[model samples]
Target: MALWGGRFEKGVDAFTQEFGASLEDDKAMAQQDIRGSIAHATMLAKQGIISQEDCDAIVSGLKDISEQIADGTFEYDVNDEDIHMAVEKTLTNNIGKPGARLHTGRSRNDQVATDIRLYAKDLTRELLEGNVELRRTFIDVAEKNFGVVMPGYTHLQHAQPVLFSHHMLAYFWMFTRDYVRLTAAYEAADANPLGSAALAGTTYPLDRAYTTELLGFDHAIPNSMDAVSDRDYLLDLEYACAVSMMHLSRLCEEIVLWSSTEFGFITLSDSYSTGSSIMPQKKNPDFAELTRGKTGRVYGDLMALLTTMKSLPLAYNKDLQECKEGPADAAKTLLDCMAIASGMLSTMTVNADTMLDQAHKGFTAATDVADYLAKKGMPFREAHEVVGKLVLYCEKHNKGLEDLTADEFRSASPLFEDDIAQDLDPEGIARARTTYGGTGHDAVRAQLKEAKAALAADEAALPKAPESK
Candidate 1:
């Protein structure tokens, strides 16, 4: 059932057949292949390159094959070089001459190029949907824990008090950027490449435009050689996935640290946790660790294709076959990791008391104490040194800034007042940050409103799928 070896006296050797086959990777694109064939056959008939009778037969046979592939009844052969050959050989065997005519204005090179674009369009949309859901989940988590206080860190040292809602919304914005990147990847994959026809334009009056519209692409690719060889869309997808995974890994790293006894800031749900075999008390955040580790894996996928395409001469090579697996793996892995993240987030317990207790330690409100003195007409630099001496005195005496008497505060600076105690309260300090995008309660609520609006707009901007396969 080999389709392109009519001139050869004998077939490839058995080992070579297995070694060269892409059935495992190509199987996922079976429906995309059928859809492209239908569009090509329809265009052939429209331009009078093939009879309408042949076009109808080809469409009908392709629809049946699509059903068979979907229903798990299609027989796949190991020696079928790729999915394009697999579908074409089956169609020719089942529907005879019209199926043979389906390849009139195309090559496997351009066919697979088109298939990858179609697959990318679909995959990108799916990833976008998951991305929106995860952002929404973070928003929900933030609103649920609104006004809860936590210690913000610089270099893992508590630097200021911030609302927990503000921290979660930080991730919402990170994923918002990821949504933009994924949208660009979809746009890159939206161009059609069907009529490239190997490396040169075909002699037939092949209507690439009609197929482009029929297959729901933005436009036909302008050059045959670039159309057949360009895999930049896959690179875009892999890059998006890699960056998104990096963001996810950062968040998961925090979760891993937060769930530990030293932090006790949060606890993961048992559903997303794993138990130690012998140590009964162990509830390991294995999934979070896996997501962090897989960020490098997605990076490898992007780099592998980049290395493969680096030295090749233009216009399709066997090395181009290495492109599909990386984008596919990275996209699927990113989607799965996002879902896991959302699940862990929605189910995990927030230790509010522990977080607030920790918020009070490390002199988390020290910045606000300096701000108070500065607002009371002291130079910021002088106020900073005054607070520094007070902090040292407290460290020696094993006391907090709040534990100092009013006279003791006045001895350091005449600007100190009894109301300075309010500045040292972590909750009040966090709420006092009223600037835009700050950690104040009002500021976070406004930020949450903007996040919801952004999510809604991006989801609406997603491309509408055509009704066909």
Candidate 2:
């Protein structure tokens, strides 16, 4: 019989049962549900709602079911409707009337809310650790290539010369912000909702604070209705995952571009690449492409949840069931993407020589030339026009900016000296940028130090994992 079937004469339709079931999705929260049940049952016993023997039996029965679930020996009945019902039915069968008494002062509304919060807290920690590990990998790669030069792009065209380390550190900061967002989501899920009791305060003398402490929540949620109905915490998590996946997608797009023959900036390791069955020379970045593709799925997850919550008059509704799968899917997808991307980045080879060779081909130093003239008292606009004319001359003559002689440079600008040759070299141009956040060697070193400190701070802020045996 259904938990709410006592007042009803007719059973739910078979089609409705199949259509409304969330067992497959909510099954992932089985262990968390058991944890919440144990805490709730103990609280009930303390309040004298159930006997001590009943509390002990409920706890013992839940443990036995948890072990069976862990070992894949527990049988899940679809007729029970969802994980909550399945577990409760199993508990009742195992321990008789005491298992039934476990639901004395609560409702599935608050119960599932508590279970998901606990699950989110645990998963957020895992993602935080994964993010920290990914940042460390990026820093490791940057440290090894600090002085290496590359062309920085604006609008897909090379605009300036920058240290390779500086470029990599840009991604490091993007991911660090992702970690912050995840931590915020964790904070959102930290409150306990176990004693909310179906959108109202229960008449029983239940100690919500004690149950909160038992379950490791920061505190009990103050409003029962909001506690049962508010899934904004899950939204925060999905939004965090969506943004994190977008960042990863951007990085993956760059990885795909870099590995192409036209770019040749980096080559992914064979282990991370795939080969075409027909094309003999194909070394496809399938993993990076998949990461890029999966980004849309994460965005979809976020949108699905947003749409699900838009029209619901809440306090607790079946529509909230639709909210559960999205954040879970988003979190899982992002975690997998992060792990794969870190592997791709750590194992990929940087083709420094190829990057350096191409760095100057697109007039990457034209801005530096303009900056040089501007420093020599020419107005920046005037200097920019002067450099543009020089570039036009070089292009018309089928020559490069570097192919021009000192006299040619003087013809373009009277301030040009033989030192212009030194400035024209891509490496020298990159190193000449000594501003605090510039792509110069010194600037990149300072950035590295700041990045390492930021990384350490994030690592320090992560919640310690629950101790395992």
Candidate 3:
């Protein structure tokens, strides 16, 4: 007979068992389920709800089962319905009556809820580590290309020259925010819901605080109804994943463009590149394209959980069973994407000369020219118009602003001087914007220093190793 089958006159049909069982999907949460069970058993024994002998037997049995699951030797049954039952059944068979006492003060509702929170805590830590490692890569790449000038774009047109380090630091800040979000998600999952048995508080005198400490939860859920039904932490996790994926997609998009033959700003390493099957000349940014494409699936994961929880009545519903898959998949997918992205970035080669050469074309110096005139007592708008006309003249003459002679500049405005030639240099143009947070050499250096410090602090904060079992 099934664990919950005593009330039924007959066993469920095989098709119904297969259709309703979550063992396949919930398999990943088996360790979490076992962890929660051990905590619950310890609490039950502490409160005298069960014998100490029984609690010890249950804990020992659970640890053995945990080892079996970890070693890939545990068998799963469709009749078990979910990981909770699969694990409990295995424990009961391994330790007999004592293992049967393990679920005395809990329900599948609270059990699954606790399991999900534990899983979320583990996932959040992983994502934070991945975020930190990827940010470290960004910092390394930025330092490697420090003060290298590249054209900053607006609407895909060259707007100005900026230090390549500044470009890389922009993403560093973006992912820093993602780190904060994932941390918040971790905080959200830190509460223990183990004693919120079935939706109402358990009557078994279970010590919730004992379980909280044993399981390393920050707090016990204050409300039983909220405990079993709440999945906001998972949502927070998925939202973090979605936003992080979006940022990765943006970076991947730039990588694809920068590696293109037309742009030639960077070259992806062969390890991260895939050649066209038919064209021997083609070295494709397939990894980058894959990262961009996988972003939508992460978004879909977020939306899937949101749609599942939107209208379900509290405290627990069968619909909630569908919740685990999205976050599990999202976490795995995001972790893989981050690792691949870090590899792609660390191995890629930046074409500094090509980037600087492109930076010099398309009137990139026009803004600096206007700034030059404005600084010389001309109203900025008037200076902008003068520079615009000069750009037109240079274009018609098939020359860049750098190629224009000082005589040509003198004709446009008396404000133009010998120093105007210095402003026309792309490197000089990039160096001129020394405002705080601007793309000037010193500003980029300051930013990189701050980034390195941030990376150091983040690395210091990471767990030194996996938590000791």
Candidate with the greatest lDDT versus the true structure: 1
> Which sections of candidate 1 miss by over 4 Å?
none
Off by over 4 Å in 3: 463-469
lDDT of all predictions, in order shown? 0.92, 0.90, 0.90
Candidate 1 Cα deviation (angstroms), residue 38: 0.4
lDDT of 1: 0.92
Candidate 2 worst ten-residue window by lDDT: 460-469
Ranking by lDDT: 1, 2, 3
Candidate 2 regions exceeding 4 Å error are 466-469
lDDT, residue 19, model 3: 89
TM-score per prediction, in order, is 0.98, 0.98, 0.98
Residue 124 lDDT (model 2): 89
Please state the error at residue 200 of candidate 1 in Å.
Answer: 1.2
Deviation of model 3 at 406, angstroms: 1.7
- Give the per-residue lDDT digits (tens) of candidate 2, residues 253-354: 999999999999999999999998999999999999999999999999989988988988858999998877888889999999999999998999999998
State in Å the error of residue 289, model 2: 0.6
